[model samples]
Target: MSLVVSSINLKIYFMKTFLAITALVSFQLAAGQKTIELKDFNSLSVGSDTKITMVKSSQNKLVINSSDDDDLSIVNEGGFLKLNGGEDLEITLYYKDGLESISADADAEVWGKDEIKAKELSITASADAKIELVLNVKKLNTTISSDAMVTLTGKAENHNAVVSSDADFKGEDLLTENTNILLSSDGTAAISVKGIVDANVSNDALLKVYGNPKKVNEITSTDGHIKIVR
Candidate 1:
């Protein structure tokens, strides 16, 4: 009887230990599967049949499709975009027939090492869109082609900042600090610099500066003229 009782107690202890280990492993897996969501900083993952519209209060990173039916707009705020931060953010913005609008409040920065093909990209702000900060990076090689106006209220810097349509760029200070600014278009684009203007332009565009001793480093154009008024 003593031997049988001792064997039964050992089996019970083994079973209890096995159950505890299993529970711990299950809990760990569950914790690893959890996701994080914030109020001001949000991330939206779109499905094949849905469109995403975002209005950010602070800074955000967005991933969208260049060939989808969704439309994006940045009205009063600004944000940033990492196309391939970890994985590819493929939210396609279809032509006028797909997603209606994806707009932000302030400046919007887009970082994509590939090509960015769009019908139209519009940014309207009380300030300027800081595109030069992300342009000097060799990891980001992007091409922007739009039919609508590409407007900037601040300054821009990059290896290539091309606008194929009419551009309205107004800024108080244009800081190309250590980078270059390139503006080009088949149509006529006008740029007005309130303070210092440091950029290089193609011949087809025009630039007008209004300030005290505007520092325009280099102005190159195949057919455009730069008029400076102090």
Candidate 2:
């Protein structure tokens, strides 16, 4: 009888300790976050060496973690949220409605934490920038140029990619229904297509195809290579 009573007391003690730790963690997380007041924005323009996590929220909001005290220049002009003037920054961007476009140049890193649902989304990364995102979009347009790289991991009904000047589109996990690609000037694309692929490769460009598409309409010469992934 005494042994069973001791066991019951121990279980109750552990449960109380667990609850206290959980509450402390929740409080710390809330303390480290603060909201930014920027509204009525439909697009994003990032131009800093920062990392951002985008969240889909019921209210259109922007947040940045207060642990890092990097100076940031944020503005909302003409339906676009532009972020700049920081070296080491961490931010959280929230939007209720669909985002139209995102452009990153020279130095920026941004990603979506949730599956971005949109009608049409355009991404432009150039001049040694890097962007990674997931999309549940109808029409997705991408232009990777001038040694930039864009990595995608999601689904798009129609995806059009134009890679040029040693740029790369790393989309092996981004399954597309129909993919149209224009690879030029030693650019590279690693994509997954389920329905059909239309490719125009030239001048030492390379297209790596995955997902075993139903049809591949290729217009290329010996100067370019279209390799199938098994």
Candidate 3:
């Protein structure tokens, strides 16, 4: 019985040591992390192998330029910008009063705003890429290029949005006073709204509309299938 008790205590001690090491490593990693800030919005250029974060407080315009290589970008307007994971590069932007735009020659992803008081915003992406916008504001408008995917989520007061992709448009638990969604794809595309969706579509693309249609004021599609779910 004494031998068995000793073995159990030894195992418990080993587990505790492992947990402590893990905790220490985690704290060190977090502490070593750094934040990059872009205050002056002149002409900002980023390589296809770089990642960047930007925040704008004053009325300044920033331009993002990238090559036709693997890249990614995340932007938080007038707030702390955070970005993680990318192959070639990632760039972020924050436009206070001037125009802030992101242009990618390769596959890239961009975000409008982050965890804070929701506001009205707009986002446009280049072709042959994917873009995601998470808004906690009153309204949001988005325009996606060909061979791209645009996703919008959060609550809004009034929203007028357009999405043109060879892929699809997906939404989850989106609430808005007025919403509009438009898709133009060569393949299959769909709109899943939790609150409302009002828009139109074209091409031989497949369009699936779900969620509360009554909450969704209007929707239109051409050469595509439209489905409404309560």
Query: Which predicted model would earn the best TM-score?
Result: 2
RMSD of each: 15.6, 4.1, 8.2
| Candidate 1 C-alpha error for residue 149, in Å | 2.3
lDDT (CA) per prediction: 0.36, 0.86, 0.52
Please list the residue runs of candidate 1 whose C-alpha ends up more than 4 Å from where it truly belongs after superposition: 1-144, 154-160, 165-179, 187-196
Better of 2 and 3 by TM-score: 2
Error of 1 at 159 (Å): 11
Tell me model 1's lDDT, rounded to 2 decimals.
0.36
Give the worst 10-residue stretch by lDDT in candidate 2: 61-70
Using lDDT as the measure, name the better of candidate 2 and candidate 3.
2
Alpha carbon deviation, residue 93, candidate 3 (Å) = 8.0
lDDT of 3 at 37: 46
lDDT of 1 by residue, 147-192 (tens): 3333333333322334443443433243232323455663333444
Per-residue CA lDDT of candidate 2, range 188-222, in tens?
Answer: 99999999999999989999999999999999964
TM-scores, all models, native as reference: 0.33, 0.81, 0.54
